[model samples]
Target: MLFRVALATGLALFITQIKLDFFESYLYDMRVRLTPVPTTSGNIQIIEVTPETVEYFKGIPKAEHHKKLMEWLIPLAPRAIVYDINFDEILGSEKNKKEFARVMESFHQLFVLTNFLEMRGEEGKLKLSEPYEKIKLFSGPKSSDTANFAKDGVTRRMMINYQDQVMLHPFLASQINTEIVDKFKIKGLFDFLETDQVYIRFRPTGTYAKIPFHEAYKGLISTQAFKDKIVLIGHNLELSEKDYLMTPYSRSSIAMTTTEMHANMFDTLILNNAISKAPQFVNTLITILISIVTVYIVFALSPAMGLFIIILLFISYLLISYFLFWPFGIWISMAHPLLAIFLCYYFFIPYRLIIENRRSWEYYQKNKLLRQVEELKTNFISMMSHDLKTPIARIKGMTDVIINDGFTVSPIQREALDTIRSSSDDLLKFINSILNYAKIESQGVELHLQSKDPNNLLTDVIRKHEFLAKVKKISIETEFEPLFPIKIDPELMKQVFSNLIENAIKYSPEETIIKVISKEIDGMVVVRISDSGLGIPAQELPNLFMKFYRSANAKSSPIKGSGLGLYLAKYFTELHGGRIFVESVYGQGTDFVVELPQN
Candidate 1:
């Protein structure tokens, strides 16, 4: 336990201190390699303007060819059209340019793809600047500012916004979403925080709608359907290299193509569900930590207790993950962490149980039957001691009164009687504590459940403890609310509260305050008793209510206690179907709360 604690603390500190970006990158690559991602992009018909298509159409007249393409596009209404080809040169005649412009105007959904070029000259550089929708920069501002390419100087990603009446990007489909929004009158932003990839609904599967560019001019395929569909005018132009990017659909040459990128973006805008970047490192660390903590607990705890703790931890993990992921569409994988816990338990638990059994056997062999006999003797003595305690206390009190007030005695005799009385009181307390433990073991304490007001019960308990608090020079404050009555045994519950308060008083320093508050929460009555005293160690918390279990810090304290008080209190509370719990930070004092269901 100590080693694991130290290791976790030291490693956390070390990880914080180190800059391991390169190493992390390597790990990330390795992890990605370990997990295979298969590409499932369906085939899309490519209308390539290759040398063959150009030759077949006679000669490649750029303007005339574009006109012919548009004619073909006007009929085959594709899901979208991307004009990947650049019109930067304006090489054709002014009349031809106007004709091409008219063709562009005729069709509305065509995504005319272009680039956001970044050129750096010694003093000045001259370049035409244009904004288009879906044609904007692909990158963020920081990357755009300092990014100058070595090859044909161009910015891969652009920073621009798209609104109707203005094209924002150099991409083909950037205009589609804005146009749709304008047409549909849809308002507000769609958040794609968790999901990454968007799924496009339909595209022509085979070569029915697609034909060679030259063939289009030759009336090889019908151009009837493209009248209203998006048309992309881009080339398999060798001079122009497409922007390569990763989309959930495809990641190869297709992603690089200008038309496809527009299609991908458009699909995402429409679908609104894209695969998001899950926090891999964060989830991984959390899972592993939880597993490790579970492992430690399993190893350190007794079987029954360990099983209970495991159940609790599992429930906590489920609730946390459910709240964190399901409602918000976040995906944190529970498989690995839960698997680690199960795997560790699968191997470690049997090994632990075996070792524990062997140790128990060895101890049994050493003591033979003596240990059993001694235990039985101690139990008997404890029971007898407890049975005689109340009467003995009464007799001692009467004797003290008689010796002090009624009879004249020597100083030595009086001192002896005082010592006897003190000893008798100590013995009586020990006996009562043991008797409580025995009663719990035998299920001798029966609860009489009734509609008990929590506030009134707290008040009564506080009243009984006020004199004790005064003796310790402590202030006891009670804050009670109008609470619903809960089913509980008043006598047993009073003992529970009294034991807890006594312990609080015993541990608290003089001039300190012990505050008790009772309130109702979600069909349950909660009583909280907070004290200004040294807190229990975090490690000791799990064992706090266990029989004969005393914390190291508590044992070292000057305050004397039987430790059975809390154990008995817990037992009695459980008899009434209630729970007691504590929250504390070392040196920051503690808060003990008891809850009973209002049923």
Candidate 2:
């Protein structure tokens, strides 16, 4: 147990560490894969960059498009307007870049684009040019990248950190924040500084509300203004190639574009408690708990059952992580924890099987010996019974003759003779049962293969047992369905039915009903003989057909029976390629069913 526990703990820890560093990234990817975007606070708003606007000034003059965006911003007097476009370098006429920059300045609500880089520097570096000094930048901790390196030196879980400083307000953030501050006529960032940042929570992936950019631009939205809110600049169009990411969540496309990558980073900021670090001890404890649980389950269950449990547990873990982790800022490493659980299970199984092997072997050997002893006793009983049959029959015949021929005996002497004759007949029948049981073991009797009508056979058996029923003051009832004749050995079949009916009559109470029914059930001929008798116990049912095995009820009864009737009946029933079974309840009655296949 200790060994299994230790192994489980180790596997869980290894998995947990991997999750903290990398698997969490996959979770983030999954979140993004659920289509993400930002909505303005409280109201519906539009930022239109339409084809018509592009055509309005003859092929979307760059200066004119910027001016139109300015126009839209001023009229709406919106909370904030974010320009997704960036102007890092002058691509068109340098004058046009300057003009666009001046228009952004005029709006005062608009924030323009600037880039920042974080990189390692040479120890004794030459002075950089002025062109490199204009970009906005902020510094924080040197990015710590963690990944796995294989023997071939290939890295998995890529984390790139090429800058010593990051852009605090990337182009979109600058634009949106600028618009909000200008429209409200109040400084931004200061109020947000003293207050806890409100995280923008969203429903999970596959559940986000998608509003088309065209519809928003066309004034079809519920609300038409954002008086005091931050607006996000992103795409909803399919043709736009600006969105893509390579994370596990980005399964739909080949890859995510650079703009989408930035969008995800911004989402991380909005949902500020994005990354979490669970204490090492907590992770370790959880690992241990899961391992121990899995090991215990595996040891307790059968292999098939254990596998089923493991599958359920694995699914449960995924579900818990799916629902719980993101909400609590808890990032559980799904793969590693499960791996640990299974590893523990695997280790425990072999150990458990090995430990139980000796106990199992002892049990098997004891049962085998008990079975052999039972067989020997059955054989002995059968042999002795056969040996006694001839003498008992002879004695019965001679006594009958002496009584019938009027040997000049007194009345009392005649009565005694009659009693002796009856006892001899009973003894003879008992011996015949033993002989039949022994005969079942011998492969001597050739089954007379013939197609026998089951309905006729059922009727005959019921008729023959009617006398025994009469003696008990029991009524025998029958119901037979016309069925196709089934191939069987008639003589063996008769012996089978005789024993069953006799046992029923011998065991049943007086003045009760014995029902015999025959029907075609599932392409087989089924004969059910039921009697209202002192029934067998539930626990003894499995051993009912064992040779010389009688139920507890039978053993305690006054009825003169050899306990070989059902045993012999079972053998003969099987000999004709049929099955026999009994259903009984204590203090109720017993029903014996003989099912013979159609073929």
Among these predictions, the greatest TM-score belongs to 2
Which segments of model 1 are wrong by more than 4 Å?
Answer: 1-379, 403-423
On the 0 to 100 scale, the lDDT of residue 504 in model 2 is 82
Q: What are the lDDT figures for the candidates, one per model?
A: 0.58, 0.58
lDDT of 1 by residue, 422-480 (tens): 67766776677787676665556677888878788778888877877898899998888
User: Mind giving the per-residue lDDT tens digits that candidate 2 earns over 1-599?
Assistant: 77766776676666566644344445444543443443322322334334544444444335434544454545656544544443332234556555555555555444322223334563223222222222222221111122321221111121112232223332224343344222222211111212212112232233223343444544455554455443434433334543322334334442433333333433444323233434457656767788878987887788899889988988887777665554454555554566677677777788788889978999999999987886787688777887787788888888988988868998998889988987997888787776676565654456787898977776787787787689789998888888888898877788788788878888888999888888998888898999998788899999999988877777777777777788877877787788999998888999999988898
lDDT agreement of model 1 with the native:
0.58
Model 2 weakest 10-residue run by lDDT: 151-160
